[model samples]
Target: MPRRLIIDLMRASCDVPFVSLARTLNIRPLLEARGAAASPPGFAAVFVKAFALVARDEPTLRTLYVKWPWPAFYELPRNIAMVATARVEDGEPCVLPQRVGDPDRLTLAEVDAIIRWGKEAPADQVPAFRKMLLTTRLPWPLRRLAWWVGLSFGRQRANWFGNFAVTGVSAYGGGELHALSPGPYILSFDVAKPDGTIGAMIRWDHRVTDAALIARTFARLEEVLNGEIAAEIRASRASEPKPVRAIGA
Candidate 1:
């Protein structure tokens, strides 16, 4: 059944110790530039790249607590984002995750295109969706085993799930209170306000690091969004049609 997928995910998530931290980010500059762009990238894409850029410099953001053969921390080489995208499956709506690897190295436009594809593409066509369907179809015992193995392993976990996740309910008029994910980091952001403020929250695993690092990461995220992310939007305007000059009248 469609519900089984989320149920399985919840079962796996319940085992992790997740702590959430929230902050209001001022991104008026990025908002203004994005609004003027010919094709504005989705907020998810923008946030994904911004967070990844911060993670690129902060290894703590890239670290994960794995309980496989032994309990230890595993740091990924790059950032992988598991973005939760809503889709209609069997005539019912469901949220499925789409993976975007090394988002820091990707252009905002590139990340947006991939996210748009995940939202618009057929559920069966999206690899993540298909994989989830297959896993859920397995017997209960097998399903539990699959989740355990996936969560226990390090590299396989990153490749299968991701180092972080992005999910939001901003389109529905608010943000998620405590969004859960199997990854070490999961970020949720609300709609941008007229004054350029947006509600952002990160629910991270406690076994990896502490709040001080995440606080600094949030500050750096705001900087990246206003700096390089805004610059990218302005760059997109280069392709805009130049205003015609009137001849002397």
Candidate 2:
């Protein structure tokens, strides 16, 4: 007899989002130059930094349609970063959203480290890891309740889900256009092409902003990723100690 699949809270919560859109970006130069650049922090870190810069420049998109207490929109001052990752928890694989605070001020390396550590280290050491764990551990009914509450209010929304998200797929080679996301904006990119280019898409909230603003943000994101982020990665890589072979001792 076939086994019955046990439903998990994580899988259930993902279905709560009401709406999402799709966009794409080709970042060949940025990808090609990443390894050649000093201290490249990988695509995820660079992407998070790029999003932070763009969000800083254009804060209007940060506003959220909150429907709690009274209908009101809330604008967050700084971005709290979150990257969606599949984590092994208690012998089962679960998708957990890792948090990165004050991403705007963090360099590519710092952001990269936070994400790397989150992936490699114990869940207890990671910030907000427990919250996700607890949420999933909640009684099935409560899990749905919490998600509905979080997704409904503006202030509560930012507290649960960050201002922006980056779901990095550069390491794995494939092209996917849209990613289902909860934040106001998210970046989903494909693996860099052999020629050193990438395809990125932004799925934004149409409730607060339109396609024009998102298009512009996507443009600025590319500029910052290729310019400032690329430079920093290159500089960092230059400072690393090079491996040396001992002359036939």
Candidate 3:
């Protein structure tokens, strides 16, 4: 087959139903309710933590589909990763801490430490620093290549990789939302409102996960945010001892 023709064929075969499914399910009310009760940490950390927890709890969210010889196939595993662009020192574009696997266990201080170090590191060393900070397995070259391929194919063929992609728009305030091209995972969270309320909008890839499942997940997240999880976070923070300094010695 001709190269263009092959690409067209693949594109045509790509799943598109996920977009429709995502549109039908709304996540605003659920997230707003949760935000009203408990405070989620800073945007970067909260998203990193939430993605880890959600992916761990919902294995289906971590699945991906790749072409096979006999027949096309889907593979499931705990292989989800979170990517975000961070602003370092004014307007510079620096990628900070692309954490892989479960980040839920990481304390707020730990997350801050990683981000702080990433920002302070020299520009040339940034990539290496991020890789070391995030994953122990994947080499920098492979990770970069994989991300590039994923972005290229994901934009062309929606169902090629994992089930979802979450984007944090908190830095942009409450007005804008991010959308992933041709994938089931589309999510955005607003800045905390004066009343400590915010909207969590998820535009899913309908082909992979159904609207009902997404809605249920959003509802569950709200429950976690409002219930014991919030309390636990508060207690955990409260237990930490405050630093005391002796008077001028």
TM-score of each: 0.94, 0.82, 0.60
Model 2 weakest 10-residue run by lDDT: 1-10
Off by over 4 Å in 3: 1-40, 68-75, 88-97, 111-120, 123-164, 181-184, 243-249
Ranking by lDDT: 1, 2, 3
Residues 1-249, model 1: lDDT tens digits: 568988888878988899889999999999999988888999999999999999998888888888879998999998999999987877998888898999999989999988988999987787877887898899999988988888899997888778889889887897645888889999999888898899999999999888998898899999999999999889988776888999996
By TM-score, the best candidate is 1
Question: What's the ranking of the predictions by TM-score, best on top?
Answer: 1, 2, 3
Least accurate stretch of 10 residues (summed lDDT) in model 3?
A: 1-10
Candidate 2 lDDT by residue in tens digits, 133-179: 66666776887788768777876788777787788555656567465
lDDT of residue 231 for candidate 2: 69
Which candidate leads the pack in lDDT?
A: 1
Q: Per-residue error at 28 for model 1, in Å? A: 0.7
Residue pairs clashing, model 1:
none
Task: Score residue 101 of candidate 2 by CA lDDT.
Answer: 81
Q: Which parts of model 2 have CA positions greater than 4 angstroms off? A: 1-29, 37-39, 241-249
Tell me the number of clashing residue pairs for each predicted model.
0, 12, 6
